[model samples]
Target: MRTLITIVAFLSFGLLSEIQAQEKHEILSPQEFCDKMKSDDVQIIDVRTPKEYKNGHIKNSTLINFFDDDFKEQLSKLPEDKKILVYCRSGNRSGKASEILENLGYKNIYDLKGGMLLWEKAKTDCY
Candidate 1:
C-alpha cells in the first residue's frame, strides 16, 4: 500500500507539472506587447482579415486571418520554438487565436490586450 501510494503521488505531480507547462498563455497591454516584440525569435501574427491587414498592421507581423478555413493549418506552419504574439482588429479574435495556438502546442503565446484599436490609441506605430 505504501509503494502504491508513492507511485500515485509521483504520477499526479508529473501530470500537474505538465498541465502547468501547457498553460503558458498571456495577455499583454499595448505597451507590454511592444516591449515583448523586441525580443529575438518572436513571431508577430495579425489575425485580422486581409482588408483589415492591408489598411494597417504592426510592422513585420504575418497575416493569418482567424476566420480562414485553414487557420489552424496556417498556424501550424509557424515555428513552434518561437514566441507568438497575436492580435486582431479588436481583442476578441486575437484572444481566440491565442487559445488555438496554445491548443496546437505552441508553447509561448501572447495576446494583445485590446488589439489594434487599443494599439492605435496607445500611439504605437503601425505599417
Candidate 2:
C-alpha cells in the first residue's frame, strides 16, 4: 500500500540520520568553539602536555594532560551530564581524546578543529 511504503521510507530516513548523528563528533572552528564555550556550564578542557598548558590556555578550561599515565582516570572524573569541549595544540590529540571520551560514555564532546594553532590564527581572544 502507498501508506505502508511512505511509513517505511520515513522510518528508514530517521534511522539513518540517528546513526549519522551518533557517530559524529562536533568539530568546531576556533571562533565557533570559543562561542560555544561562552556557556558557563560547559566543560572546557585542554588536553595537552603540562608544559604546553603552562605556556598558555583557555580562560576557564581544565588541564587534563592526554599523555599522562592516568589519563583515562582523569577523564573519567568529569560528569557526563555536561558538554565537554576539548582542544590540543594542533587537533590530533584532541581527536583521539574525543573518541576515548565517547567510549567512556560521554554523550557530548566538541573538539576544536585545528586546535590552538587555528585559534591563534583566527586572532580570537585567549587567556
Candidate 3:
C-alpha cells in the first residue's frame, strides 16, 4: 500500500512537470512574434531555402533551410541554452522546425504561427 501511494505520487509529479514544460515552447502570433523579434539575445532561424530566403525574410534571421537533408543535424548543433525563434514562408515548415528544436532538447522554442504571411499582414517592419 505504501509502495502504491509513492508510485502514484511520483507519476502525478512527473505529469505535472511535463505539462509545465509544454508551456515553455510556444507558437506565437504574428504581432507577438514580431514584437519578440525586436528583442535581443534570441537566435531567429528562417528555415526557408536560400532562393526563398533571398526573395525576403525577417532582417537578421539565420537561414537553415528546413528542406535540407541535414536540417535536423544542423539544428541540433545550436546552443540548447539560447532561446530560438523559427519561421518559414507559411508556418508549416517552421512548425516542423520547432519540433526538431524540441526533439533536440532546446529549452525555449517559439515559432511564428503564420510565418512570413501573417508577419506581412501585421505590417511588421522587415528587410
Query: Top model by lDDT, which number?
Result: 1
Q: What is the C-alpha lDDT of each candidate?
A: 0.89, 0.89, 0.85
* TM-scores for every candidate against the unseen true structure: 0.79, 0.81, 0.78
Candidate ordering by lDDT (highest first)? 1, 2, 3
**Where does model 3 exceed 4 Å of error?**
1-24, 125-127
Better of 2 and 3 by lDDT: 2
So what's the TM-score on candidate 1? Answer: 0.79
Q: Relative to the unseen true structure, what is the Cα RMSD of model 1? A: 4.6
Q: Quote the positional error of residue 97 for candidate 2 in Å.
A: 0.5
> Which 10-residue span in candidate 3 carries the lowest summed lDDT?
118-127
Could you arrange the candidates by TM-score from highest to lowest? 2, 1, 3
lDDT of 2 by residue, 1-127 (tens): 9999999999999999998878646899988898888886689999999899999888888999988999999999998788899999999999999988988988779999999888878966543
Off by over 4 Å in 1: 1-22, 124-127
Clashes of 2: 0
lDDT of predicted model 1:
0.89
Model 2 regions more than 4 Å off: 1-19, 125-127
